[model samples]
Target chain A: MYPTKYHKPASIEDAIAALGGGDDAMVLAGGQTLLATMKQHLASPSDLVDIRAIEGLSGIAVRGGSLTIGAATTHAEVAGSGDVREQCAALAALASGIGDPAVRNMGTIGGSIANNDPAADYPAALLALGATIITNKREIAADDFFTGLFTTALDEGEIIVAVNVSAPTKAAYAKFDQPASRFALVGVFVANGASGVRVAVTGAGEDGVFRHAGLEAALSADWSGSAVDGVDVAADGLMSDMHAGADYRANLIKVMAKRAVSASA
Target chain B: MTKVNMNVNGKAVSGDVPDETLLSQFLRETLRLTGTHIGCDTSQCGACVVHVNGQAVKSCSTLAVSLDGADVMTIEGLANGELHPMQAAFNDNHGLQCGFCTPGMIMSGVDMVARYKAEGKDLTSDAIRAELEGNICRCTGYHNIVKSIEDAAAKM
Candidate 1:
């Protein structure tokens, strides 16, 4: 890692101000992804604003028909949270399944979503559950939050405060984990809520986490795994890597989507 | 340089190191506590696992400066001049071959047992194997390691 200045901010306002001081300043939540990237020389921020000391950025609460999780809340907390398990078991399961126990103890939901890794698990859940990304600057809906691979709509110096996800009537996530990293080789999150049925696919999209409109439409009409049986996910515009080809990922998307729907049911 | 003060193995230590210094570096270089090994610096290997505020975390991926005032327990702290229960179990069960991943595996196992005990869950063989995902043992093929953890869980 390169030489960098570290600032521990006690409040969100101070964090933002510290970030503004350096053009290449980056916010450090759990330091799971950022630290690894820095170690690999992929990223070198001039300043690191450590926001873990900030009081209000780490917690989970259900309020007004939505489950609000602080951005700094660790995956372990979410995985073990009774409120989350009761309100959104799929979210809890997804949190528990990320990486390993040690990683889960350190990785934060905010960091995971903000990094917007294409193989990450949270984006699919956020997109399917129609969560709201609440940042210090503004509230962005999940639909507009993730822009592309390892990208988001967050602006420079913008710090995510919390995420508010409306409780779905039924929701579940199924993932085919890559053996080594445990990241989602292909993951699908299916949800049925007030808005309608939503199916989000992660780790398989060429651009990034995207909703499967075909599966969503079919499931919306039938609300069953068989509804998506005939729907074929296109291999074009899907990710292909050493672990899986685009066609294999397309098959995984269907299989995972079916599993998620069955689990939801 | 960043000034950091934290409790390590029940000892309050202070250091002024570069902001980019990892917790593993601080423990190995500054404090001379080499028990916390760095097998894979990419955070995939659990050789650098340690307890920060009673939770197992990858020290290689954690910044030392960020842990100011926190309580850290490395493998060296697992016992007080005597073998801890988990360490004894490993020895009795021949859990290690190369012994490179022993410290991390033991730390993670102890932590897993603690967490399971708190949750009132049994530390079954399946649970031990599942929780040992982070710690990679290339030599042992994890057969003895899993047995060691299961043995330790029983006594712990």
Candidate 2:
């Protein structure tokens, strides 16, 4: 790892100020990904603004009919929260199945979405639940928040404050995990909510997590596992790696979607 | 260099180290506590697992400077003077062959039991296997490890 300065900020304002101070300053949340990248010399920020110490950045609360999860809240916290399990069991299950227990203990939701790893689980949940990503500067709808792989609408020095997900009537997620890393090979989230039915697919997209309009339409008409059976998911623009081919991912997407719907049902 | 102050095992220790120094490095090098092995520099292997603020975390992936004022418990801290219950269970169950992953497995098991106990959940065989996913044993195929944790859970 390259020589870097570390700053533990006590407040969000101080964290932002620290970030603005350095051109290549990076916010450290849990350090599961950032520290590993630093170890590999893939990312060498001049300064690391540690935001784990910031108050009110790590908790779960349900307010005004929406689940407000603090950005820096660890995946373990979400997985273990009674309120989260009661209000959004699918999200809790997603959090619980993220990485191993240790990784989940250290990795934060803010870091996961901010990095926007194509294989990440939160993006699928966010897209399916119509979540609002709240940053220090502005609030972005889930559709607008995720731009591309490892990309978001967040500006430089912008910090994710929290994510607000409206309560869904029913929702569930299913994923085909790559055994070695436990990353989603092809994951699908299905939801029936006030906004109607929504389906989001993660881990198989070349362009990152995307909503499956076809499956959403089918589920909107018929909320059942069989509704997604006839929907044909194209292999085009899907990720193909040594783990799985694009065609296999397309097939797994359908299977996962069906499983998610069935689970929710 | 960054100044760090933290409690390791039961000892309050402080040191000044480079910013790039990982918690594993600090424990093994500065403190000379080699019990916490670094099997994989990456976070995948749990050989470097330790309790940070009472939560199991990968020390290899965690920076020492980040743990300032935090309480850390390594495999060395599991026992007061004799073998910890989990350690004894592993020995009795022959959970280890090469014994490379024992420390992490024991630490993770102890932490898992505590977590499940707090939640009023049983530390059943399936639960132990699921919770021990982070710790990898190249040998012993995990059957004995599961048995060991089950034995320890009963005693704990």
Candidate 3:
């Protein structure tokens, strides 16, 4: 990692100020991915404004048929929250399966979505659940928040403060994981909420997390496992790598979607 | 350089280290706590696992300077005169081949057992295997490691 000044900001205002004061400063949430990226020389920030110490940045609250999770809240916290379990069990299950226990301990929901890894599990959940990414500047919907792989719509000094998700009536996430990395080879999140059935797929698209309209339409018309039988994910824009071929990923996407649908149903 | 202060194994230790210093480096180099190994030096391998504020964390992935006022525990602090139940169980179950991953394995085991027990959840062998996903024993000695954790969970 390059030499950088570290600032432990106690408040969101101080954190934003610290971020704006430096040259290429980055917000350090959990440092599970950022630290590794820095060590590999993939990123070198002039300053690191640590936000986990900031109060009001870590908690889970369920109110008005929605779940508002503070940005700095760890995956472990969300997975163990009784409120989350009762209100949105699928989100809790996704948090529980993110990585190993240690990774989950240090990885935050804010950090995960902000990084927006192509194979990350949170993006699928966020997109399917219609989550709102609340930043110091303003709130952005998950659809507008995630721009691409390893990229988000966040401005240079913007910091994610909290994420608010609408409670889903029925939801479940299914993933075919790459054994060593635990990243999804292909993952799908299915949700039946106020907006109707939404199906989001990750780890297979060349453009990062995307919604499968065919599956969504089919499921919205008939919410059942067999509803996905006629829907097929094309390999046109799917990612192909040594781990899996594009066709294989497309197939896995359908399989995972069916599994998620069945689980939710 | 930044002045980092934290309690390690009940000792109030402070040092002026670089801002980029990892917690694993702080423990092993500054405090000479060599029991916390740095296998892989990345987050993938949990050889750098330690207890930060009573929660299992990969020290290599955490910044030392950011952990001010936090309490940390390592493999060296697990025993109180006698071996900790997890440590003794590891020995009895022959859970070590190279002993390279034992420290992290034991640390994770103690944490999983405590968490599962507190939640009133059964720490089954399958559950232990799932929770051990972070700590890797490349020696393929997971069978004994699982047995040791199960045996230790019963006693814990």
* Candidate maximizing DockQ: 1
lDDT of each: 0.93, 0.92, 0.92
Candidate 3 segments whose C-alpha is farther than 4 A from its true place: none
DockQ (Cα-based) for each candidate: 0.87, 0.80, 0.82
lDDT of 2 by residue, B1-156 (tens): 888999998899999999889999999999999999989766788999999999999999888999999999999898988999999999999999999888899989989999998889988899888888888899779999999999998899
Off by over 4 Å in 2: none
Query: lDDT per residue, candidate 3, A109-207, as tens digits?
Result: 999999999999999999999899999889999889888878899998788999999999999999999988999999999999987888999999998
How would you encode candidate 2's per-residue C-alpha lDDT over A1-265 as one tens digit per residue? 8989889999989999999898699999989999989988999999999998999998999886689999999999999889888888999999999989999999999999999999999999999999999998889999999999999999987999999999899999999999988889999999899888889999999999999888988999999989888898999999999999999999999999989988993
What is candidate 1's lDDT per residue for B46-137, written digit by digit as tens?
99999999999999999999999999999988897889999999999999998999899999999999999999998888889899888898
Model 2 chain B worst lDDT run, 10 consecutive residues: B36-45
The alpha-carbon interface RMSD of model 3 comes to 1.1
Candidate 3 global CA lDDT score: 0.92
Count of backbone collisions in candidate 3: 0
lDDT per residue (tens digit) for residues B64-100 in model 3: 9989999999999999999999999999999999999
Candidate 1, A1-265: lDDT as tens digits: 9988999999998998999999799999899999999999999999999988899899998887789999999999999999999889999999999999999999999999999999999999999999999999899999999999899999987899999999899999999999999999999999999879999999999889999999998998998889888897899999888999999999999999989988983
* Strongest candidate by lDDT: 1
**Per-residue lDDT of B33 in model 1:** 98
Off by over 4 Å in 1: none
